[model samples]
Target: DAQAAICMVRGHAAEWNISADKIGFLGFSAGGGVAIASTMSATQMERPNFLCTNFGPSLMPVTVPADAPPLLIMTSADHPNVAAGLVALFMEWKKAGANAEMHIYGDGTGPYELMPETGETTTESWSRQMLQWLKSKRFI
Candidate 1:
């Protein structure tokens, strides 16, 4: 769970010179499940400072906390699996009065292809989008 990870980091923070507040979570697919779990966990320490979900499931209901971490969500409009859920989650988060942002990519060509790290593909640029969000929050 995120609690263990956060605690470990916090425990070594002084020697590692990394602040607990700067730690965040970014997840894709199944990993996003974990991210969501971490965000909605009852233990505050288990939560990340910020979170990014890339085309993840949204059915896991959570009571958005006042201190809910900033969130960035992305999904291809044409994605066969999780696009609708991701968008639903974006709206849900907004309605929950949480700090949330979303991006729905893809054109007539269908969802952007997930290219290799060295390759430049439209869907692949989603990583850059995440980075930009992190930058806006001064996480990078």
Candidate 2:
């Protein structure tokens, strides 16, 4: 899903007058997993999956830029899958020389949804922190 969205976004970049190199992706939880995977797994402007071939280009380009803007990952410390996945993804990003960041909350009131009613926890506030982080990184 992440790869597909990126392919679609990049395929339409020219329509929006945005550079394919300037487009970036971000997500949380499973979405986060997918975003991280998409960044590491795909080549510059190339869709990571053959499914993206549904869209056309002048020609299939090689060496699509792998380096993306920094990532902001958020998860609960107790959520091993989320924690480990994001951590592993972060390591991969650094190894690939792509910038990345992560925030893990120590089980501070479990399952605080990013919904208005739930009231953002210090953990949930990572969303805000992520925004600041992205701004600090000049990603926004």
Q: Using lDDT as the measure, which candidate wins?
A: 1
What TM-scores do the predictions have? 0.81, 0.61
> lDDT score, residue 61, model 2?
16
Model 1 regions more than 4 Å off: 107-119
lDDT of each: 0.73, 0.52
Task: Identify the leading candidate in terms of TM-score.
Answer: 1
Stretches off by above 4 angstroms in model 2 are: 17-20, 47-69, 111-119, 122-124
Q: In candidate 2, what are the lDDT values of residues 20-107, reduced to their tens digit?
A: 6555665544454445446556655654321111001111112223355455555566656556655665565567676556566665
